[model samples]
Target: MIQPDLVELVALRGAAHDIALHARKPVLARLQGAHRSAQRGRGLEFEEVRLYTPGDDARNIDWRVTARRGQAHTKLFREERERPVWIVADLHVGLYFGSRLQLKSALLLRAAAILAWVATMDGDRLGAVISDANNQVSIFPPRSREAGVLPVLEGLVQAQPKQPGEESFNNLNKLLTTLKPLLQPGSLVLVLSDFSALDDNSETLLANISLHNDIRLIGLVDPLEYTGLPDGSYRAGLPGRLWWLDGNRTRRLWQEKWAARKKYVDDMANRLNLPVIRLDTANPVTEALPQLLREPSWQI
Candidate 1:
């Protein structure tokens, strides 16, 4: 199969546009429009008219409507601006493996790129935090411009997966801890990862982050990771050195581990009240992404 490249990833802008056209779905609506701020203040758009109450501001009274109906009425307004959107993508060694369409790294990058484009199209500022084994890079919130999505996509293109032995250095929790301060309240935060690296501390930090921000977790996995291998010996490994999986027992154990990891992630996300969308490498991102968006749980 052809490997995904920067050009392909960058083209997700158009894919996002296509997805937005299907706005009957709540998730698509959220992705395609300016996010309504929870706080109502000045500079908001008129939402509706309601019967005036004791505490209603007199200045907000709709005199014409009140005079017509002969009853006091007040205007309600909706926050008119879009909030910043942050994409946090994991580039650890664990994401480098895939048995099908694309590597987990590629899928994560593609998903991030698509969301970045959607956020930009909806008139929101875009930011990103990308982490590998020993390094974390951040692109501060940048106003959406014609080419706003390019920088984040470029970073993904340039990122290299961590070496096998360097897995211990994958400190996603530290990266997230440092990122927490930078996120503005009410911002939308999308974390794309296999989430196999999360520990107790990471879960705590994620929960804390969710308290102030809208957090969505996208879990990337390969078919092999979810389904056990067939009953047979198979050779696998890097170029210089190789190893063999001798029997079905080993495959079952591997599948059990993957299932446990998936459960851990699911349970943690549930505790944090985070919405998670699972993406598989067995299918093309274009196909997999829309399916995820269509899910009822994809809504805020």
Candidate 2:
């Protein structure tokens, strides 16, 4: 596999042409704003808190106020052209396994690169949280795309384990817990992970964050993980720590675990009412991401 370094990220610039920031259609757009939208839905800026009305998104409801005043209220937002975009880059261990095409780590790196390009080109502020092996680094400074995004790209490559299963086990719950305090109410967070280490705490954290911010889950998946291995001896797992899946029992067990993982993610997303974008490791992330962002539901 080609190294997921700065050069690779730079090459992904062409993949995000149609990726536009979600903006509230401002009555008067700023002279030097990001992208502005004439059509309106749930854009970025927090406009005001008003009584919950029909057709209002319940996700934006302020639960604390509702409890105190014994009346439902909603947080309203006008789109901020230069919205803050946060990417949760999961470079934890166990991501180096990919049977076909590139590994999960590469897919994530490319996806993050594409997103950074889209945000920077459109003038949206870009930040990132990169996690690996029980540690995480947050890039939350205001910077030009070159200044801010380059570090994130570098972090993505550096945080990943030298090889898969190298003991880099950063739990999703831990990462999200740390990330909660850093995010603003109207920020957009794209959690790019395989959901391999999610727990009940992770679900709670995700729900809590989504209450005040727009959260999207992007699951990086590999076909081999879900499908049982074909009839033949095949080496799998990390380099220097390889294992063979020549037996039917092992493949079956792997398939079962993967199915459960997929189910849990789906159930969690449904419970939280969050949008999820699942990208196959077999496909080109550059090509797929642009198409995914254009979908109406993903316009956010």
Candidate 3:
């Protein structure tokens, strides 16, 4: 049987569903950044009129239509534009394993797939920088239509962890440092990772990237990492070293480590004011991601 740890292209392609994420107009993406487009005037063509929502621009309110309708309406516009969305899937060696339904790597890639689908469906371009163990990095430049999304999906499947967890040589700091230059000011970036090893250096790199682009951190979490093992003795260790997780007493220490990891993410998000979507391996990310994206709770 094919384990859920493996990335399935067929399943990913099918994961694309009609995701309507609009406040008033059909936005290419709901992930808004600080970099606003400079060009204005005749370039903006009128698209339609729709009922005003909380986030809709007050300047766009149609006063004439508002009086007749008894409720506020806003004008929506369609400009000759598309957003560039970049996804960084960190399938480092550490994310290879899961005691739940899917591996952390698999869940991360699935979130990547859904974001690619959602962005492309709304007429945005897609690109990616996918990293794996052994220092393999697959970089795809932004492209529209299937040209943009297919290559990313293929790259994600290729980089999916082949086995259980192990020490990783992949460096997120170096990757983000190198990636910061390539990102356009207004680009939407999704970074999918477990991020258990992020330190002060890594946090600085991410903060620099967030300064220009709209970044969403998608955290890949497996239930076992926080829950620990059932009440039983288990042998666990690295390739050359071995240790035993014997009882509930030892398991508390295991769970405490995960708690620390959680706090690290929370602190980073709070400091950077970045939106975070935690995708658990136990839950189907394909379902959870869409709802998470649509919620106002994650809006910064």
Candidate 4:
């Protein structure tokens, strides 16, 4: 398996550009055309016809439909354009663990890079919010394809896990709160994380963001996380302070906690009408991303 590095992350742009152009049309179409407004505009796509009201524009009258119905009707047009796309990546310590191909942190960065490249290729503005365990940084949406993606890739290259004495665990809620102001309606928001840092406040922020934007949560999980540890003695925890996982008791308890955590995230996502994609550390992102982009929602 290829370890994620700055070079690999940057190289994703070319692959993503290709995928966006050919394979992801279903998802891209949905993301680009999801927002529809009833307000009359100069947009070229006709949406629907409605009964003419007193304030309705006379020029928009659908003469053919009006003659058939024997009543005045006005045509509505849809706004045809691409929406902004933002990626939020969590690089907390919890994501530093993996039993397979790459660390969750590495996977997160790779995934974000691909999404950013895809967004740019689709003619959508691109932006990102990244937390490096100690600090959070954001790149405002930029229309230039390369300009929109380079900063995010640079941020991933510089990211590091929080040291023992660094600022307390990065508050995902606070990060989202700060990001709220920059989000625009109908935007596509992708959150990549292990979701070990979620809380009530984070849920609330996600709910609010989903009200006006299309939000998808991408969960990164290691095989050890989804499946319980094998029954055997193993060292766990920080360096020089490890504990033994000697029996089924510890493994079962860990599994139970993981299940609970998974349930919480799933419930919250469902309540907020958010779609979730779970990827394992063992799978290459190139294999997983196409499926995500070809989801049925995008075909609509």
lDDT per residue (tens digit) for residues 1-300 in model 3:
133422464456566665622233334433442113531211355899999999999999999999999999999986536667788878788887777777777777777877887778767778888887755777888888889988888887778768655566445765676678878666777888888768888888888887777787888888788888888888887666788777677778988888988998899888998778788888887778878877774432
Give candidate 3's whole-model lDDT. 0.74
Pairs that collide, model 3: none
- Measured over all alpha carbons after superposition, the RMSD of each candidate to the real structure, in angstroms, is 8.0, 9.5, 11.0, 8.6
Error of 3 at 53 (Å): 42
- lDDT for model 4, please: 0.74
Candidate lDDT scores, in order, read 0.74, 0.77, 0.74, 0.74
Candidate 4 stretches with Cα past 4 Å from truth are 1-3, 17-80, 160-170, 298-300
Query: What stretches of model 2 exceed 4 Å from their correct place?
Result: 23-81, 133-138, 142-144, 166-169, 234-244
User: Which consecutive 10 residues in model 1 have the weakest lDDT in total?
Assistant: 34-43
TM-scores of the candidates in the order shown: 0.77, 0.77, 0.77, 0.76
Question: Model 1, 186-270: lDDT tens per residue?
Answer: 7777888888788888888898887777787888888888777778888877657789886586877887898899889889888
Name the best candidate (by lDDT): 2
In angstroms, give how far residue 17 of model 2 lies from its true place: 1.5
Clashes of each: 0, 2, 0, 0
How far in Å is the alpha carbon of 55 misplaced in model 1? Answer: 17
Say which prediction, candidate 2 or candidate 4, comes out ahead on lDDT: 2
- In candidate 3, stretches whose alpha carbon ends up further than 4 angstroms from where it belongs are 1-7, 10-14, 20-80, 297-300
